[model samples]
Target: MLTFKVLAALLDYPNAETVAAIPEMRAILKAEGVDAPVLLLERLERGDLLDCQAEWVDLFDRTRAGSLHLFEHVHGDSRDRGQAMVDLAGLYGRHGLTVQASELPDYLPAFLEFLSLLPEAEARNLLGEAVHVVEALAERVGRRNAEYGLLLAIVAGLAEGPAKPVRLATGDMDEDIDAAWAEAEVRFGAGAALSGC
Candidate 1:
């Protein structure tokens, strides 16, 4: 659904087009039964984008609190995380979905795109597997009153079952971002590869 695309776009770095996209996103969310936030559109309409973009970077790009990467929340930098990435990317490939080199299969946005390709029941079941991560992210981002939090909540709502949270270790506060960036890329079967953060 276009709502998945819109939600995915909301996680990306903001630009002029992002502000212009607000109405379409809000309308699509409404049509999809998501009670979209009006405050976000109001801020964008008032051209408070500088502040919004700054908050986006501070909340997501800088901190691990709302990382869009699913494995980062579930597995950290452990060896298991690498294996999970490979497995997930392979799952996408097996289903004939070609993930871009720049996007991780476990990335929530990419995952949402994959969900859009699945039948409703399958999509809901798959989403249920990661509902905890979405719920935790929603809670964290909602505390800051970020509109992006609503997207997470909407995703969590789509999945079946209780909103149980997955326990995770605190990430290394002193960890190097560039170093983390240099970690091995996730390689799917048949020579596909994606270098994602």
Candidate 2:
């Protein structure tokens, strides 16, 4: 009973050559025990794989659409990139995802993993703020949430890359848990505050 929607707006048919070259991707799906026809139809109808693939695509679309409207409000200038990141982070937060200080090292990588799956613009918009918030909170938490942090780090790393040259570090803090809580608060507030864009 995994009910989901495949919006026609995102549909795209794969060419034969492209499909032929994706045996590895297909094999992975098979290894995961997905029904081939269901997977194909789901991907075909949604323009991407299930799991994070479809979610990222949808988030990208929403971010892009929101950016367009935001530009109008600012006389055609781009909105604050940080705000876009906040918006994206808010989306993930709503799904019960957030980075913790103790788990910074591991979580950072996960965050980058998820970013890699996204379009450059979408990844930049969403993950850039997420890293900042995560790092900031990590400094306060003293220790990160090992499980959640690892999950986020893996997902983020998959989307983007390692946070090395980027130096996305969470600094020292008096209260690490508070920092993480604040990050979640920001995300929740943004989710509630954002209007039609």
Candidate 3:
């Protein structure tokens, strides 16, 4: 059985006051003949539960390379589950993106669209705060043009409802858009551009 202390620590519970409350956790680990507490501590020390800090570093690098498509997928799927939005925002912050109230209107759509994938209650709780930060960032960056504008519009539509129509460009603008975004990333930083979305 897993030790209550181990499970509590893994879950970041306030305190593993007693081992009795986590009987099921203990039983499951015990049944598996696992030394739950030791394993948990080892994983924690090794940052395994943190899912490889280097992975996140690689993710950040890919994001800078403009190759990280997971965020786009997550943004697409975030209908009400705010966790994805929160995670993305945290990543942005970690990468030194400045999220502020002024930037909210521009970036809020994307943030909200992500939150939308979460439960309504979670979305409701997260939307306001997330929007506030996004707005602040937008204000810092000023207004958006075609590329950023379109991205924001897409995010906004998704947040408001599913299957919202978006008018994205087709054909030859891909290279131009990529170049523009890359230049912007170099100038403003990837986190800022992402938050601007």
Candidate 3 weakest ten by summed lDDT: 136-145
lDDT of each residue in 1-197, candidate 2, tens digit only:
00000111111223443344345444543564433334443443445334434443332223222111221212222355446545545655765676554432122334444444545567655554444344333232213323223323322332233343332222233235224423233435555667434
Q: lDDT tens string, model 1, 38-133?
A: 666676667567887897776676656667788888787889998999999888988998879887788887898788778768877888998988
Q: Which runs in model 2 stand beyond 4 Å of their true positions?
A: 1-144, 164-170, 174-197
Give me the candidate number with maximum lDDT: 1
**All candidates' TM-scores?**
0.77, 0.25, 0.22
lDDT, model 3, position 164: 24
Instruction: Tell me the tens digit of each residue's lDDT in model 3 across 16-42.
Output: 332233455556556745444443334
* lDDT of the candidates, in the order given: 0.75, 0.35, 0.36
Residue 18 CA displacement from its true place in model 3, Å: 28
**TM-score between model 2 and native:** 0.25
